[model samples]
Each structure stands twice: as structure tokens, then as C-alpha cells.
Target: MSRKGLGLLVVCLMALCQPLPSRAAGPLITPEEAALPPPKGAVGVDRRGVTRGPKIELVSGSDIASLPTRFQLKFQTFGGATVDLASVKVLYLRTPNVDLTERLKTFLQPAGIDMPDASLPPGEHMLRVDLKDSDGRAGSTSFILKVAR
Candidate 1:
């Protein structure tokens, strides 16, 4: 084989050996995470500081019937500030709380998050979405995801 052809073959082999991304592997939330106790507080949108913070809107239906459901969220900033994407946090509301930011990072966007396929264990799962604005104002929102038994 030509030298260039051999190099290309080697690169393809290396790529095949790499593990697939989490999104491709399976569900984003595990059974254990879903079974944890809910956080101590009301479940809804909240804002911190006199200045308004960023907003997280759940574009998809809050009630999820089955696995591999479409998950969509939109972000909005206020008070002449922009949404601080880096400050975004997706927490599985529980006694200890599970951070799902890393798993959902790829789906995140400046305007919102769009996950064509997402899965969670069967139960009523409460998720807390928290983020800040460029001005450092904090905003939070929580919603219950009801997965069919």
C-alpha cells in the first residue's frame, strides 16, 4: 500500500477503538439517581437578587411517558445581561443531588438545550435547573418529570 494509504488506515483503526459518547451509549439518568429523595423546597421557577436572573424554559412536555424522550429547554436573560452558559447546572433533585451537567453538555446551546433522545428511570423525577446571568444574578427552575411505570 502507498505510505499515505497506510497512514489513513491506521487513523481509521484508532478512531474505531475509541469509546462512544455517553449520549450514544444509553440513558442519561440511572435508576439509582431517579430513586433518590426530592429536594427540600417548592418545585418551580425562582429568581435571586434584586436584578433579574436568567430563565430556563422547558420546551418539551414536563410529563415524560417513556424512555428516550425528547428533551428541550430554552434560556433567557434579563436586566440587560446575557445568559452565562458556563454557570448552567442540571441537578437531579435529591438528598445529595446528582449533577447531570456533563452528560447533557453537548445538548446545551446559547438559546437553549435540545436533546432528541433522553431517558430516565420510571418515577416522578424532579430536576433543578440553575444558571446565572453575565451580571452574576442567579435564576432557578424545577420541574417534575413523570415517567410511566
Candidate 2:
């Protein structure tokens, strides 16, 4: 082959060998975590005031999801109160109710959770997200994600 042609081939090969960008660094919910049994009191109670409180809304294409799926949530507040982003907490509704706040900190935002790519094991999984508003009124929401094998 000519030197020019060989160089071009080598460049193409190098580009092909480069690693592709990952959707997510790691699974949002590991297999073991998903396998855990439900906690004794896994129910999340809303502490929102009768008059007004913050609201959490799940915004996704479907409840049935696949691995590395887009997970988006929108927050709304009542009585002119704004969401207190720092008070956000995420819990995996399983035995002992796993705290996923730290793991999902990167995806949590002032608006709400906006994870472009979140991975979870197959089966049904539940998540409880809670947050407070500037007025100290609390709001919580439960989300069930069903994944296929």
C-alpha cells in the first residue's frame, strides 16, 4: 500500500479502537439493592401543609423502563414557596429503605431529578423522593419503575 493510504488506514483503525462514552458511570440500582425485601414501614408520608406545599412530579415516557433509561422529575411549589433543593432525599423502598440521595446527588437539581441515563435491574422497583420548600412545608412522591429482563 502507498504511505499515504497506509497512514489513512492506521488513523481509521485508531479511531475505531477508541473507547466509546458510557451512558452512566454505574448502575443507578444494583442487582443486590433491587433484590432486597421491602422494609417494615416503607410507606412514605407526605408532610405537606393542608393549605400549600411543594409537589414532585415524575416526567417520563413510561413507567415500564429499560436499562440506562431517562429519569426526569419536575418540582412545583404552592403558596409562592420554592423548592429547597438541598433538602432533597431519595430512598429505595426496600428492606431498611436504602438511602439513594448520595448516589443520585449529581442528578438532583433545583427543578427536580433529571438523570439522562439511569440503570436498574429487571423487575419492579419503587423509589420515594422527598423534599421541603422554602416555607418548610414538605412534599413526597413515590415512583415505581418496571424493567424488562
Candidate 3:
């Protein structure tokens, strides 16, 4: 096999066999990230420690009124997969003139952490996040977050 192809195969094997580092051994979201409502759908964490991904779901109780003006949304991928933040595309639609894609990338790239929503409108929003790892592995999730006013 070509060196590049062989290398990818090695990566794939490592990804399948290796456990995530200790840092990722916890819940996808800590209790403090955002006050998520009860989990509505089934819960399972993928190789990336992502329990909520590949699809979108609003945090159960998050509504316009109770939605915090400030919050964090984190992203990660395991199985030896790493994403390029700039290449990590996002689509924040259904709201007025605002594109959060760049903002989200900015949030993850600097500290290598979650995206922060410090100031957001209180209403229903459709947010989509698509991540492609450096190895070409991809995962995405889209969900609605409603802020009650």
C-alpha cells in the first residue's frame, strides 16, 4: 500500500483500539456549561466523547426567558481524529441577520475549547455544526435552542 494509505490505516486501527485520554472520561457537558433541560432522546457518546451530535436537539428546558446571556458549547472528536477549526463549518439559521459560524470557530480555536454565547437573542434558533477531522472523519449535529423572553 502507498505510505499515505498505510498511514491512514494505522490511524484507523489506533482510533478503533485506543481509549480516549483520561480527560475525556467524563460527561460531554459538565453541569455548568449550560443549564440543559432533561435529556429527551437516547443518550450515547460517540468515539469523540460527543453524546449529543450527528444531529441537533435543543436542551430540554432551555427557553428564551431562562436562556443565559452567556454560555459555552464545546466540541471534540476522538478515535485519533482532530478537526481544523477554520474548516469546522457552522450554520446558525432562522434568526435575523447573524452568522455564528466564524464566531463559533473563534471560540474553539483560541483556547481549544467550547464556543461561547455571551450575548444571544431570546427565541428559537436553528444551529448546525459540522466538523471534519484532519484525518477526514466527519461528525455533525443540529439542534434548536429556544430562549424564552
Candidate 4:
């Protein structure tokens, strides 16, 4: 074959040998994905060590109509493990429909925790906690909270 014809043939063969483009594959599942199951054995306890079961409890004075609210959440877990907690997110949603995410952003800014801000108003709000561990293990929990004022 002539030089130009041989070059053209080589180019065609190379093109045919190339692999076809494919859609990006999904993310790989790591070992952590198999280890951390849904937050099993979840229980909320009060300061007095009283188990509240799997329910969100509001303090006596935690009326939605009140202002400047403060509350705490308590849970237990076995040792011999660690969590990054950097990916933890707390979403607060108020009833009757109001998104205070931005407001909560400012509230959490000083804390320096890289978490999603709440998008709810002052009232009975739902607290959604999403967490991913250092090994990529993931778990989530949610509870109702009264955001006073």
C-alpha cells in the first residue's frame, strides 16, 4: 500500500480499537456502608437518666410561643468506634410552613461545625439529624422539637 493509504488505514484501525464512551459509573460502596446500619437501638435519655424511648420530648417551659429556646439531645452508642461528625446536619422545620434555614445558619456559624442549616421558623419544628462517619458509614435520626419563638 502507498504511504498515505497505509497511514489512513492505521488511523481507521486505531479509531476502531478505541473503547466507546460510557456513562459515569455510580460511586463505589465502601466497607463502612455495610457496617453502619440504621441507628439501631436509638433511645433519647434525659439528664436524669430517664429513658424517653424513641420519642422527642419537650421541656415543660418549651412552649412554641416562648422565645430564645434551648434544648439538648442525648443518645448512647457502644465504644471502640469514632465518628467524624463533620458531615452531621441538623434540619429544623417548623409547622404551618416557614423555612428558617438561613436564620439557623447564622446560629450555627459560631459553632464552626460544617452542618446544614435549619429551614424552619419559631414553632414546633422537626429536627432531622444526618451523619456520615469517617469510614463512610451513614446514619440518620429525626425528632420533633418546639423552637420557642
- Candidate number achieving the greatest lDDT relative to the actual structure: 1
User: Would you give me the overall lDDT of model 1?
Assistant: 0.82
Please provide, for model 3 over 58-117, each residue's C-alpha lDDT reduced to its tens digit, 9 standing for 90 to 100: 233244464234334455555655565665665554323234565444345522444333
In Å, residue 129's CA in model 2 sits off its true spot by: 0.8
Better-scoring candidate (TM-score), 3 or 4:
3
Lowest summed lDDT window (length 10), candidate 4: 25-34
lDDT of 4 at 84: 42
Stretches > 4 Å off in candidate 2: 1-25, 40-51
**Clash pairs for candidate 3:** 37-61, 48-78, 56-142, 56-143, 63-147, 63-148, 64-147, 64-148, 65-148
> What residue pairs are clashing in model 2?
none
Off by over 4 Å in 1: 1-25, 40-51
What's the lDDT of the predicted structure labeled candidate 2?
Answer: 0.79
lDDT by residue for model 4 (7-97), tens: 9999999999999854222211122332333344433333333332222223222244433233333322223334443554555332222
Cα lDDT, all candidates:
0.82, 0.79, 0.48, 0.39
Candidate 1: tens digits of C-alpha lDDT, residues 60-145: 98888767898889998876788888999998878888998988888888888888888888878788898888899887888878
Off by over 4 Å in 4: 1-65, 74-79, 93-122, 147-149
My TM-score estimates for the predictions, one after another, are 0.74, 0.73, 0.48, 0.35
